[model samples]
Each structure stands twice: as C-alpha cells, then as structure tokens.
Target chain A: MHEMSLCENILQTLQQQANAQQYSKVKTIWLEIGELAGVEADALRFSFDSVMQDSIADQARLEIIDIAGQAYCSHCAKNVPIQQRYDACPECGHFPLQIVAGDQMRIKQLEVE
Target chain B: MCGICGCGEGHTHSHEEDHSHDSLDHDHHNPIDGHQHAAQHTHAQGLSPARMVQIEQDILAKNNAYADENRRYLSQRGILALNLVSSPGSGKTSLLTETIKRLKEELSIAVIEGDQQTTRDAERIRATGVPALQINTGKGCHLDAHRVGHAFEHLALSDHSLLFIENVGNLVCPSAFDLGEAHKVVILSVTEGEDKPIKYPDMFHAADLMILNKTDLLPYLDFNSAECIAYAKRVNPKIKVLSLSAKTGEGMDNWLKWLKAELELQRIDYA
Candidate 1:
C-alpha cells in the first residue's frame, strides 16, 4: 500500500519541523487525512510506529483527524457532501460536481518538547 | 524499493543507528537554590513545557516540487512527455511498441519503462530503434517524481522529442504522483470489468485522457462500451477519450492525430 510512503513523508516533515522548532522529542502527532485522499487510517497507523522508530518521534502517539468530502454542486447551485469522486449531486442528481475539500493529506500540528 | 527517496531496490527500513541521546540528564540540576537534594524535578522548571506547533504543510509537497522542476525542464526543451498508466495486462507495452513503430521514423522517440523487476519492457521499446531506459522499482508500487527526475539525467533526450513514461502496472497508487507529464493517458482494456471506472475513480479523475483499448475483442466479450465511457465521464467530465486497438491498428489514427496535435500545441505554447 502507499500508506508506507505517506508514513515516510510524515517522518520527513517531523524531521524538518524538529530543526526549525528545536524540539528534540516529539510526543504526539496530529495528522489530517481527507476522505478522498485514498489513505487507510489503520494502515497508516500500523506503519507509523515502525516508520518513526529510532527517530525524534520514537514512541510517539499518532492522532488522525478524519475529514468529510465536500463539493460544490453546479447543477443545484449549492454545497453538498460527497463520499466519493463520482458521487452525483444529492439535490439535483447531476454528475460532475466540483470538489472543494477532503482530498488533501496534511500534517496539521505536533506536540513536542 | 524505497518509496520516499527511491534509493535502494527492495530495501526496507534498515539502517545503522545514528541517533545519540547524550542530552537528556535533567535529573541532576535544580534551578531554585542550586542544590541536588532529592533528585525530584518531575517537571523541569526552566525548560519550556510541551507545546503544539502549527504546521499546515501538504504531505505531497516534496513530490510536487520535484514534478514542477521536471515540468520546467521538459517545457524549456519543448518535449512532449506523456505518462501512461494502466493495470496489469492492459496492452500498454503493445500500444507503446505500435506507436513507436509508427512515429519513430519521423520523430525522435524515447521511453522510460517502470516495473518492479525485469527489463523486458525497455528491451521491447528499444527494439523499435529508439532509446529506452528501464527502472526497476523492486517492491515499489508506483514511481514518484524524484525517481523520474533522476532518470532524466541518463536519457540523452533531444529537443522537440516525444517521451513516454510507462508507469508501473497499477491503477491505484500511480494516480497520486505527478511525473511532470503533459497529460496522463490511462489505458483500460475491455477485458477488465466495466465497473472499473467507478471502483477506481481516483485514477480516472486524475487522468486527462482515457484510452479504451482492445476494440477488436469487443465482439466476443459482453463488455458494454457505452456504459464504460459514461462511467468514466461521470467521474471526469472533461477527460478526453479514444477507443482503439493497438494490435490491428483499429482507431489508432485518432490516437496518433491527438498526439501530433498535442505536440504541435506544446511547440506553439513554448515558442
């Protein structure tokens, strides 16, 4: 799975932040993963522990924040919730809704010393 | 393969320990009266308490940076680079071989083949009298921008040439990583399930064009071409589509025309 790659990316971000923030130890990490990001939270959590071993974030706890998919329905002229990319507009039953959010993977914040 | 850096072939998280912990002796000092009396400073007084640092950084920022560099590199030289993605056994290699055979006589064609192992695809492309390079990703599912940038160093690409990057045969992971291509052409054979577009919407959504290959085999199969196209359009309203068979040269003229038009457009935009 690509979750391993995403985990490595998370560790690299942590290292870069450690340099700028001067935090020798990272206690907990808060990751924001979107619904359409195609990342499984369980797989990411399983890889996070091994990926962070022996690094500054060793033994750190991972906190994943789930984000719901949001889109703008041009047919209905309103914002609607979409669980997937091909989801039709709930109000007008139209295809091709412009995606507004919930397709991003970002490191929101970290608790460190 | 190392997914983040693409350094080693089939290498895991194995490395020599280099982290030193020589700066964690907070039990010996007392800031109040300069006395090590009871060895009991549960919370270090002078040290700042743990705080939350705000870092709203995109996870794919690094990959995107590399992709941008590649885009600039290709644009400056007026190169028409296309990233072809598909599932296994989708006739991507056959399509490339056929396309190269048709265009190599008039243009400089090059290919970069990606697979977990083996150089057969590259060999096949090279047999068409064109330069080709094979990248063995060994256990890696997708090719990132960093590895593709590294591949550019070895390829003696000329100005105004066509470069095709055949991504690893996977419909899932490769959609997320942009390799600085002018367009992503996803090849879907009719042998696969018709519901693939709905099942793997992310890939179809990221693609600029979808090629419905193996039209010759449509007579024997129960695959409905109209429904498949509709499903793809449902996911990506702007994605251009072409139906072709890379073997019998059926509907290939449309694909070649599209490529030539895109190359001409790139030249005009760069000029």
Candidate 2:
C-alpha cells in the first residue's frame, strides 16, 4: 500500500550499504517478497523507478523472488501451505494457523558496480 | 533494542557523501559515489565489474527497530498503549472519548490523535478533560513508530497509565507498521459494510481485538452482528470481539473491564 515509501526505504538502505559495501551504482535489486507480506509486486515495480530517480540506485532493475505462504496448523500437527492470511488449515479445517513462513518483505541481494 | 534507533527521525543523509570512499580521486565533486568503488583500482575502461552484494535485510527493519524502542519505553513504565485502527468513520474518536470519560478518574489517560490535517479529534479528546496531543501526518496514510516516539517524548506519560493512539483513518497501511502499541484494536461500525473483515482481511488478521461499534443503530439498519463476528473469527480465530454503542454508553463496562484486565496484564509483564 505504501510502495513509494518502501522504495524510499530501499534507496536509504542502498545509500547506507554503499558506505559499508563500497558501491557507487546499483544495477539490480533482488527482493524476496512473500505472498502474505501485503505488498503488491506491480505497485512496487511501478513506484521503484520514480522513487529512485537521480539517486544512487536510479534506473535499477528490480528482481522479485516470489515466496509462497506456509503456516503450522496445530489441528493437523503439520505445516500447511496457504495463500491468504486468514486461510484455515487446508488439511483439518482449522480456523487459524501459526504462520511459519512467507510473511517476509526483504532485500535479499543487490547487483552493484 | 538500541535506544538510538529512533534517532532517524531527525537524521539527514547528507553524511552519506562525507564518507571517504576509496574512489576519492575526485578533487571536489565525486559523481560515481553511489556505485561502491570498494577496491582502489585503475580499470582501463573506467568501468567497474558488476557484482552481487548480499543484504538479506527486512524492508521494515528500521521502522521495526523504532517500534522496539517505543515498546521498551512503554512496557518498562507499565503503560498499556493500544493502536486504534479502522476505516474512516468507524467511531474511533467517539469510542476513545467515551473510554476516557469512563476511566479518566481512575487511571492516568492520555491520547495521541493522528489525522491527515486536523486537530479536531485531539480537541475532542481534550474536551473530556484528558491530555491529548495531535499528530498531523499531512499526506501520510498512517502513523509510523518514529513519529510515535517523538510524540512520546512530548507527552507527559506517567507510569501505569493508558495511552490511546487514534491512528489515521486507515485500515491497510497501519496494519503493516507497528507503533509499539500493546495491541491493535480494529473497530468496525455497523453503519459500514460487514463484509469489511473479508474485504480487508489483512487488517482483520493483524488486529488482536475487533470492536463492533455503532451497535445502537443495529435495529435501525439491517446490520447482522452474528455474521460480522463470524467473519472476523473466520479471518482471525483468536480475535476477541466486543459489541458496543459508544454514543449510547451501552456495552462500555465490558470495554472498561477489558482495559483493566490488559492494564493488569501489563503490570504483570513489567514485574
């Protein structure tokens, strides 16, 4: 929902890491986005170019890694795959499950010069 | 848990240019500063090879850090801060004022009201004789933890008090940003569609409690209370629901009771 601000966050991180990692320009950024992370990939891509304008990572290509959602359903006593945050256990019709994975929105890697 | 995490609110990235990159060959202005020229090398073509740098950091890590600081500050003092989130016109202000009016005499009550461009909610809160501070987010869709941290420094929050943060009338963005609140209470008025829980399932799923406000008009409208709670539970089975009419003062005792219980829990957690 706040993709523009998120892009700005990426820019900030790129600038910070530039000092620590010693990179002048960012060629690409690989982000690991999970299904339940509540970020729209299209919106993020649309905002990336505008938010990174004239910055260190300006015109950087975005690579998104899709991660499916997984949760531990106690009723089934196993981790199950799910698409939505409110999804019941696919195996046992459990109303709620402990989210075990796929809630991440992270910057996994960056290609720099 | 670093206390300095919230210092970014006043930070300027101008220091980024001051860092002496190894490519300090430029007499004054360095154009290729963004590209980390880590190795001091003389490339024949003046081009650096592209290489992968692993970051593996959460996008919201900075904000989460600030939230952690705020949470530590509040929890250490035995304060119970609740983030009230909902779509526009969910009676969040009314419920807040009513909640304050009921408990102001017994507890130290304070408020932080967030809106796009108005202090009116804060004014309403202050009219109840409780201290209130207003945060104008301007174009922001929600209140972040950094701003909440600043507000915390300004407000005179005594120990073992109740802090109510009325977030900007947004259900989507606020669900993602934690403002160091003890719990997120999503309020949905019957006047709005009951299908909200399913329509915005992320908010429903993130909220620990769901307040079904404006139940006083339940008889006037065809608002089905049963289905609404069912949908909320379907979305979040552990979510607790409390039906109340903030305007009519009905079902407020249960709300107050819940507050006291949470305050007690906060005390136990602190001890």
Candidate 3:
C-alpha cells in the first residue's frame, strides 16, 4: 500500500525536525489528510505504528485530522463541500468546478519534549 | 494533593507550570473497581486525548516537497512526462512499444518502466532503440516522485522531449501519488469491461487521458466503447478518450497524431 510509503515520508520528516530541534522524544504527531488526497487514515496509522517503532517517532501518537474536500463552483461563484470531484455544485448545478482545498497532505505541527 | 505535579513520590518535580495535563475524566470503565487500570492501559495504548488535538498536520508534506522539486526539474527541462497507469496484463507495455515505434523517428523519446520485479518492460522499450530505464519497485505498489527523480538521473532528457513513466501495474495505489507527470494516462483494455472506469473512478478522475486499448478484441468481448467513454467523461469531463488497438495498428494514427501535436505544442511553449 502507498500508506506505507507515506508513513516512511512522515517518519523522515519527523526525524529531520527532531534532529534539528534536538528533541529527545516526540509525544505526538499531527497530520492533516485531505479527503481527495487518496490516503486512508486507518491504513496510514497502522503503517505509521509499524514503521515508526525504531525511529524518533516511536511511541508517538498519530493524530489525523481529516479535512473535507472543498470546491469553488465556477458557475455559482460559491464555495461548496465536495464529496466527489465530478459532483455538481449544490447551489448552481455546475459541471466543472475548481478544487480549492482538501486535496492536500501536510504536517501541521509536532508535539515534542 | 499538589495539582502542579502529578506527584507520585514525595519530591516535587515541578518545572514548567505552563505544561499541565487537562483532566477530562475520560474514564470509560468503573472508576471504583480495579478495572480502571485496564481502561487506563487502553487509553495510554490507544490515542491519548491530549495528543489528539495538538497534532493537525499532513503526513505527506515531505513527499509533496520532493514532488514539487521533480515538477520543477521536468518543467526546466521542458519535458512532457506522462504517467501511464493500469492493471497488470493490461497491454501497457505493448501500447508503449507501439507508441515508441510510431513516434521514435519524429521525437526524442525516453521511457521509465516501473514494475515490482524484472526489467522486462525496460527491455521492451530498449528494443525500440530509445533510452529506457527500469525501476523495480521491490514490493512497492506505486512509483513516487522520489523514485522518478532517481530514474530521471539516468535518462538524457533535453528540451522538448517526451518522457513516459509506465507506473506499476496497479489502478488504486498509483492513482494516489503524482510522479511529476505533465499528464496521467489511464489505459483500460477491452477485456476488462466497460465498468472498469466506474469501478476505478479515482484513476479515471485523476487521468488526463483515457486510452481504451485492444479494440480488436472488442468483437469477442462484451465491451461497449461508447459506454466506456461516457463513464470516463462522467468522472472527468476534461479527459480525452481514445480507442485504439496496439496490436493491429488500428486507430493508432490518431494516437500518434495526438502525441505529435502535444510535442509541437510543448516545443513552442519551451521556445
């Protein structure tokens, strides 16, 4: 699964940050997985636990904040929550809308001691 | 009962008064019984309430940075990279072989073949007399931007070049990661049925082009090309659909024409 690879990237970033800050232990890791990012939260968490065992993030709690997909309706000129990419705007029934947010994967913050 | 320190021992261990554990009384089990120990264990082993709210980050930010670097590199080189995604035995290699044979004379083409094992696809492309590199993913389901960056090091890509990244034979996981491709082409064979686009809409939705491969087999199979195109359009209206048989060279003219046009456009943009 790509979740494993994603977890590896997370661990790499966490390690870099920890090394830079000289943090002895990481208490928690905050992640924002977007709805259209195509990453499963449960699968990522499972893979993170397995991959982080020998790393700086060992025993670190993974906090996933799932962001809902949002689209800017070109026709309606309104922002709307998008469940799927091809979904018509709830207000104006537009066919093609520009995705404004919720297609992202980012590390927001890290709690460390 | 000093609240400043979670004092189990007599010595006061207080240092930072700013760090205080927020007590929410998350006791799910009987607090009176010794079973509270079991509940505490569950809470500690699982997600801590305090730890949950503090972290709100995207885990793939690092990968996204690498992907952005790859995009910059490809754009600087003026290379139109295409990531071809499909299931195994979907004739991706055959389609690439045909495309190379048709376009090799007119264009500077290079290929990066991704497979779980073996350099079979790379060898196939090399047979067409073009520079090719094989990336054995080694249990990886999809090729990421970093792996692609590594592959790009081996290829001699110049301005106005065409680079094709034949992703690992998977429709699901490969659709998730962007390999710094200018366009993503999802190929569906006629033998896979018309419902494939609907079943794997993520791949269809992510793709810029939908290639309906193996039209010669359509007579024996129950695939309706029109319905397949309709389904793909429903998911992604902007996606261009082309039906072609890589085997018999049927409808290949249109495929080659599209490539030529894209290459010309890219050359102009680069200039």
Candidates in order, TM-scores: namely 0.87, 0.86, 0.78
Model no. 1, DockQ? 0.48
- Per-model CA lDDT versus the true structure: 0.82, 0.83, 0.75
What digit string (tens of lDDT, one per residue) describes model 3 on residues B59-138?
65555665777777777767788899999988999999999988888788999888888777888899999988877777
- Which of 1 and 2 is the better model by DockQ? 2
TM-score (chain B) of candidate 1: 0.83
Best by TM-score: 1
Question: Which ranges in model 2 have alpha carbons more than 4 Å from their true place?
Answer: A74-77, A89-94, B5-48, B269-271
CAPRI verdict (incorrect, acceptable, medium, high) for model 2: medium
Ranking by lDDT: 2, 1, 3
lDDT of 1 by residue, A2-107 (tens): 7877787677777766657767677999988999888899999998998788777889999999999999998788889999999998888987899898999998
Which run of 10 residues does model 3 chain A get worst, by summed lDDT? A16-25
Off-target runs (Cα >4 Å) in candidate 1 are B1-49, B269-271
**Total backbone collisions for each predicted model:** 1, 8, 8
- Tens digits of per-residue lDDT for model 1, B16-38: 11332111111111111222122
Interface RMSD over true interface Cα atoms for each candidate = 9.6, 3.7, 11.0
- DockQ of each candidate relative to the true complex: 0.48, 0.53, 0.22
Best to worst by DockQ, what's the order? 2, 1, 3
TM-score of chain B of each: 0.83, 0.85, 0.78
